[model samples]
Target: MPSQRGSARRRQRGVLLAGIAILLLALVLAAVLASALTRGKKEESLEPLRWQGRGTTRNLREIVLGRCYGYLAERRAELGDKDCLKIWESLKDAFIHKNPCNATTEDYQPLMKLASHPIPCNKSLFWSKTNDLVHLYTKSSRRFLTLEDTFLGYMFDGISWCGDPSAPGINYESCPKWSECEGNPGSVFWKMASKMFAEAACGVVQVMLNGSIETGAFRSSSIFGSVEILNLNPDKVSEVQIWLMHDIGGPQSESCSGYSIKKLKNILEERNFKITCEDNYRPVQLLQCVHNPDHPDCSLCTNSTEAP
Candidate 1:
């Protein structure tokens, strides 16, 4: 009887041990499932925000088409052969039904090819940190042409667009800012367009820089410094002319002899290109003086005889 009772107790202990082992296994499975769910939730939360800065601009298609027609109407002599509809389709296909942040220069090749045109030699003007002044100078003087003055740049200027893998394709709810991602649609388009503009440039190319920028006028990271300057064909481009202009009210932080300007000159020279640097180029300065006529620096001429 004693042996039988001992055997029975051993059997009960084995069953209890088995139950504990099963309970441990179940707990481990539950822990793993909970961890996986937590990870999934974390990933979902980290996805990029769908709505950025006013979403894609409204009437994107109409705006693009209108600009295309307007460009053809104005520059018929130069770009009369371009197919507007095809151009639009190429532009749309670039980012449609795709991730907005995945934009690449290759995606814009079709549009570039379709819209390609020759920039007149010695007429290319590149600007860095000088948007308003550069455009103003280009418009008022008509001596040079910037990218925005071209057909491709004009059509998409100030427009925002992106795509979704879902229905309707376009993300009309919002679009990423240029700073949000390197592959931003607008940023990619402009980088390619700038590159093309630089590659096609011949003779002397002009660059306008803002001298008042404390961070230095010729930033290597800027489109002009990074894209346009690097893409310029040394054989085709004879020289690079740098125009360092400062605001009329003063705060002149950089000059032709400054570190940034010298850096730009060195890069051009290294690439076997001649370079010329000018400070407060008179023509552009005169334009700046238009609004600040009372500013002392606006008096570019000391005597009546010096007035042009």
Candidate 2:
């Protein structure tokens, strides 16, 4: 009987040990799944790229007052009122305490009304995907004004903001990526702003397109193509100058005579606007040549004609 009891005890102990092992395995699996889920969420948050310190209202305010206020101060007299406080208030009112994904262009109408101004004739510059190069060139030369150079655009160019219905204010932690919704606040604002900027274009206007794109630089989905180009008034704007930017090295594909560009030209000409195209604008090429002097296309940098 004692031997029988010992064997039974051993069986019970083995079952307990097996149960514990199963529990531990389950825990490990759960942990691995949780970790994978967290990693996926993090990766998904990186969509619709934004600059640093751009997600929160507090950080955005600091940028507006500190960095952008200086830009506003330079033209305060012309700007009138110069109440950046009002601008901030209106901007936040458009998105805060609302659905992050449902924001529309109309949401920002109040801010636009407060910030709207007429851009000088022939000074308006439009670009498609060439954000970095266009901004760099425009900042260095006072010859043109891209949307960001404007008071409102300057204040919020690189910033990102969105709202939560459950939350009292902005959601700086995570917001629906811009591409996740057509009514994304950031994209809607820019599209509306681009429309206004294009509507304001007069005399000779310039468009800088990246020549490296094989599908063609002028995409109808782009802000320039979707909003700006359509809004341009043929009566006010006499000419559209296309600056096709290419890398310093030789694999240049799109040019003034490229099929895609010719389509763009035909569109402009149909609107009764004169079309002009330059292979590589001197200023932009010079910038590339400066950075990459040893490139084969550097010779063409100095030789290329400047935009008239």
Candidate 3:
């Protein structure tokens, strides 16, 4: 009778173990289903960054920067407006002479002599992916490349590229193709060009390691078309964007999806970019490339009735 009881207890224990195994399998399946359901809901909540042809594009861009990245457009945001002015004066003086690339020429020494950043590439900017874009996040059906996050990453990398007190640039290789790339002999030049890279002052610092960061001259004369600076630290932040006029076609060919896609792909893979361009030349759908330290002068953000 005792032997029979022992056998019976063993059978009961085996059944209990099997039951627990089945329950655990069911829970795993349920969890997976829940995850799938959550993902479906998120996809339904967001929209991609669309190229809303023309007038709305610039406005939308400005909105993205202002509402997305926390930066200001005013000249006052810059610490040394006077120094920039000094740099510009030096540039103007150098340009007065017929020979331009002779920055080493005594006539152009003033421009070459930079007390701070952009000595190699003055008035430059940086572009990079943000934390959210890199790691990505899901919320509802909406997909947002958060402006603040991405720009912060760019600025962080950019500052490091420029470095403190901003060193002078030593490398400015020819842009190769003489035809469309750098066509108009001496019309273009790199003020600050260096292959040596450093950690970003803004982002994860790992960003600048790729050598895609740059600090060169922007094509803007007026502050209206100038580059905007977005410094990221702990204390402050605000969203930002811009909306500029875009031709459905004609002028600014960089807007072509083919070109943009290629450029983006290059940036992603190699962290390298070559903006061998002239102002307002090729056909364009819209100007899509804009990010932290590498973008232009503007700033703003307002509450949206449309849900974020």
lDDT of 1 by residue, 79-189 (tens): 759888999899889998888889998999999999989999999999998999999999999889999999988898878889876657788888887778789888899
TM-score per candidate, chains pooled? 0.81, 0.77, 0.23
Lowest lDDT 10-residue stretch of candidate 1: 45-54
> Over the stretch 51-131, how does candidate 2's per-residue lDDT look in tens digits?
222355557767766655787668877677766788778888998877766898778998898888878898999988788
Model 1 CA deviation exceeding 4 Å by range: 1-54, 305-308
* Least accurate 10 contiguous residues by lDDT in model 2: 46-55
Candidate number with greatest lDDT: 1
What is the overall TM-score of model 1 with all chains considered together? Answer: 0.81
Per-residue lDDT of model 3, residues 216-283, tens digit only: 12222211112122122212112111111122222333322333333333433343222232222111
Q: List the candidate 2 regions with Cα displacement exceeding 4 Å.
A: 1-58, 301-308
**Model 1 residue 95 distance off true place after TM-score fit, in angstroms:** 1.2
CA lDDT of 206 in candidate 2? 96
